[model samples]
Target: MTDTAPASSPAESPRVIALVDDDRNILTTVSIALRSEGFVTRVYSDGETALKALLDNPPDLAVCDIKMPRMDGLQLLQKLRETSALPVIFLTSKDEEPDEALGLAMGADDYIAKPFSQRLLIARIRAILRRSALVRGAPEVENDEQPAEAIRRGRLEMDPLRHQVLWNGQPVSLTVTEFLILEALAARPGVIKSRNQLMDAAYSDDVFVDDRTIDSHIKRLRRKFRSVDPHFGAIETLYGAGYSYSDG
Candidate 1:
């Protein structure tokens, strides 16, 4: 005898992911990953089978390889976009800037080149899915109802939702490392965070990385801020204590 739920109840539907790639290894790897993430994947070696499935029922997202026989990824993307507004990402062997730009122009939300780290790939996937979820009948994100907006200082405004930092009424581009460092320091105001603490917070699980790399990245970031203004002292270093962000 087996215990069963009521037959009138319905089972949850997994997120459908349509993946198009010719490589068997890639298809298998992607299917396994998506499945682990509660995503139901349909993979096709060629563009034909994938296109038919997409026409029958669109997937939540698509991760496609650019170089494929019969119909290339770009062509398939074009065909899909003809009628659907589904989100798509392109994985390409070509690392050329123009190739990436072309994929972006062709409606790819993001483009990853060959030999990418699987962990980074997962992060990208989550980011795309989060964005898609927000766009599709859902709010971006919500915390407890008792919180206010982020702390602001000087001309810099931090938007954690969009991962953006506006400086002097203009958006400034910062790498992931830079953004995290800025956020951690900016939130503390006058409180100085030691380099070790920053390394722990920003690069917690990061291995084989040296503290000098942090210094190097900060140097580059400071150089970029130098372009903003000479008198601008957004990030202040406290001799040996660490760094803090302030307008004064």
Candidate 2:
């Protein structure tokens, strides 16, 4: 007699997320929360092991603890940046605001303070993963048979199809959130976007992030572009009103 089994659907294939922390409790608790949300998790006790494993088999996203034994999160991230562009989110303690800012400045996609809400974390993870999928064209359905072409405003060029950003003809690396915010503003040049509107663009409806989060991302974006082009001042800040892209 032959047995038949139903094939696993695309939705059943859980997205992999790596969790690296020195605390066993955090690892276990976060793993439970992630698994409950239909995400496969890889837990590592230290940055050293996590870095090694991540290089061997990369995950869709990673949540790393800032303070760890031997190899710290910053060190791990710096080393990883040398070879990989994998998205990273740092887990910081309540008193580590400075560290969180530094991490963001150092190219981390995002950060979560200690005593974080599991629901919030899940929402953020989903938001990041969704953006990644959009960039990779991995969405289950084709909503648009004719996708929009790349948008070019001055030296800043955004390619939705290729998920590439060129600043003065040089490649500029941007986080998913940063890219979305820039795209939103640049799509309509000279139009100011409020903090709330920019937040809506960077995150999903389920993710309720602070306005200041958008500010941080904007700062990072500026620093990144300035690194590529010292005179890069395309992103204009309207203080209180929000941000906009300069056409000239």
Candidate 3:
């Protein structure tokens, strides 16, 4: 494990990003890139070591590789979710679509295939951090000027400031991406949002996500809501079109 502390003081500290992967080259390369962008980076060679530090002192976000010795990204994410909501982005092989889907289903904020560009990775990191900042109500990073008021749609309720969601009055846990997508739908009940539109709502313009990425997130959203209420069906799919929220 290697830790790089930011030069900034606590009062003006930059965001901290944890990088977990067995490849030393990736650790070195990504850490350097992140540091250059004013981010403090902590790199771990494996998942087990990363998990302990993650729980002991959480970072603003984490980028983890799916395949690793000791524990793997999936296991680390599973354990982390038990206590923390730290934003995570998975690193997967280009051919590993199943793993990407699994990682997203396990609550990853996003995923980037291996051999990724530093610019794309950095863009994704910034995007997730921005969403997280909004959730935490950080004034410096708050891009939206609108009020962070709570929104209620039938049995579903969302508190943007608190980053809280409820179904039938029961709390439901959602990742930053899922929360954004759901919010876009619920904010305009019965309005169908195409995959591209939904992607725009949840991701930064510079970061491109395939249609499957949005589809996986939608499935995860429905699954989470269903876990709270077996009959959960507020999200509707329009064949060959997109998805919409139905409070009625």
Highest TM-score scorer: 3
**Candidate 1 local Cα displacement, residue 45, angstroms:** 0.8
**lDDT ranking from best to worst?**
3, 2, 1
Error of 3 at 207 (Å): 0.8
Q: What does candidate 3's lDDT look like per residue over 1-118, in tens digits?
A: 7779755546667899999999999999999898888899999989999999999999899999999999999999999887777899999998888989888877888999889999
What lDDT score goes with residue 247 in model 2? 83
Cα lDDT, model 2, residue 150: 85
* Candidate 2 segments whose C-alpha is farther than 4 A from its true place: 1-12, 141-148
What local lDDT score does residue 216 receive in model 1, on the 0 to 100 scale?
Answer: 50
- The C-alpha stretches of model 1 lying farther than 4 A from their native spots are 1-12, 95-97, 139-248
| Candidate 1 residue-wise lDDT at 43 | 80
Instruction: After superposing candidate 3 on the true structure, give the runs of residues whose Cα lies further than 4 Å from its correct spot.
Output: 8-11, 142-147
- Evaluation by lDDT, superior candidate among 1 and 3: 3
Instruction: Give candidate 2's whole-model lDDT.
Output: 0.80
lDDT of each: 0.64, 0.80, 0.88
RMSD of each: 10.4, 5.1, 1.8
On lDDT, the candidate that comes out on top is 3
